[model samples]
Target: MTVESAILLLPWIALVALDRRALAGDVELSTLIEPIAARPVPGEYRTSIAYYRAVLALRAKDARSARALLDAVPRPLPRKRHAEAFEYLGALLDVVEGATERTLASAAAHEHGPRRASWLAVRAHAQAASGDVESARATLRMLRALRDPQLDLASVARWELPASRLASELMRGEEHPFR
Candidate 1:
């Protein structure tokens, strides 16, 4: 492999190693975020770090803090990271703040992207939260068609799986009467 290819491959290999280790035991979200946030990277990468921290905050049930962090995310995120950030942020808004309509709108706006499945999944949760069962089911049907496995492992291990699973259940007909 060329030097450039080798350089790119190393990050992926490290991420895979981290994923395996995370699966073996509990991985702290803050532990993952702090290091990334401390070093100055490109603005685009910093936006992703901020978004991940927001996801961690939401997972910790701190909606207020999550919103604050999310608000600080720089606009016009790098093209490569934009869709995933939007999907996760929308889901967090739906779950934490109960802003179903806004979340759904945000998710729907990104439907044409590579992260469509993730956006659909978040939209499904938003619809379910809004008591729109039919819409949620339709969104899930779309997601099933795409079959994106990354949806299951999108965020840090401590939060991503549980949050996505909860969102899936909410979409799959479990009535959340409490909003």
Candidate 2:
């Protein structure tokens, strides 16, 4: 609403508009880390940066580091981002814990819309990881059954639209413990 605020937000908007994912993997996390850390709490800017950082850690097969970022997205993310934060957090933590009932239940508690789809994908992967093929297949089928055109839109396409991404990742031998 003011010149100073507009100036402050200009860079953040540009940073988001340019597609940070285009940045090369080898660009040195240090270069971009400071900017992401400088964002304030509870907005899309902060959550998105944190999620991207977590994704990078996951890409390196470093769940421990990713966990720290995922965990910081607020325990109850103010309703707007609540489902996503919990979905990623639950799936990651459950996989780390060997997909036990406790973790699955926790993940299930926050499940919503595609968040449920993502959670199921993680659950199925965990089941397969634990040698429960039949269970995994069942869960996978359930996720597939929920498929719809809505997922193609950007509003629902957060991180490759969880369910589809998780399915493809599983098939491609990519280890995305969570979407």
Best by TM-score: 1
Task: Pick out the ten consecutive residues of candidate 1 with the lowest summed lDDT.
Answer: 153-162
Task: Give TM-scores for every candidate, taking all chains together and pairing residue i with residue i.
Answer: 0.62, 0.55
- Give lDDT tens digits, candidate 2, residues 1-179: 43234325654553343233322232344445455457563465666666667766755557788788888776555555545554655575556556556656655674564457556655665665566656665676566577733221121213332233445544456644442
Q: Which portions of model 1 show Cα errors greater than 4 Å?
A: 1-27, 78-80, 152-179
- The lDDT for every candidate, in the order shown, is 0.57, 0.52
Clashes within 3 Å, all models in order: 0, 0
RMSD versus native structure for model 2: 7.9
TM-score of 1: 0.62
Give the candidate number with the greatest lDDT: 1
- Count of backbone collisions within predicted model 1: 0
Give the lDDT of residue 12 in candidate 1.
34
Clashing pairs in 1: none
